[model samples]
Target: MTTELERELKQLIIDTLELEDVTPEDIDPDEPLFVEGLGLDSIDALELGLALQKTYGIQLQADSDDTRRHFANLRTLATLVEERRVK
Candidate 1:
């Protein structure tokens, strides 16, 4: 079952990225957020990161390996946000 954080992150991703034809229910928490899955590109990553920071007040270190892991999928992203969220 999907957690509330995962659902919220899925919705945030769809809304922040302006993903047409996609909904939170359509996203798989374990699926990758880029190329092979959602097909998001580098620019989308940047935009998503900015949106996450603004919305959650969490700091993301661009060069950290954890950042890459965090962005791997909805579940990981939600885990990261839950760990770091200040709001």
Candidate 2:
């Protein structure tokens, strides 16, 4: 069962990245967002981060290890966004 935040994050990722071949339901919450799982690369990460910051009004420290963890997967991303979303 996908949580509301997870569903929202899936859509956000798809829309933000302009992934025409992917849909929200195609994403597994526990799957890694990069490399083998979603096949996202570093550039995708940067783009997604910018979109996340713009959408959630959350400040992300590029050099922080926590930031990497937050971007680990859809579940982690959703948790971070839910905890930090301004509106």
Tens-digit lDDT track of model 1 for 10-81 = 888999889989978889988899887999987898899999999999898757576788899988898889
Q: Record all residue pairs in model 1 with backbone atoms less than 3 Å apart, i.e. clashing.
A: none
As a whole number from 0 to 100, the lDDT of residue 55 in candidate 1 is 92
TM-score of each: 0.93, 0.91
So what's the TM-score on candidate 1?
0.93
* CA-lDDT, candidates in order: 0.88, 0.88
Q: Going through the candidates in order, what is the number of backbone clashes in each?
A: 0, 0
Instruction: Looking at model 2, report the run of 10 residues with the lowest lDDT sum.
Output: 58-67
Clashes by residue pair, model 2 = none
lDDT of 2 by residue, 10-42 (tens): 998999889999988899999999887889998
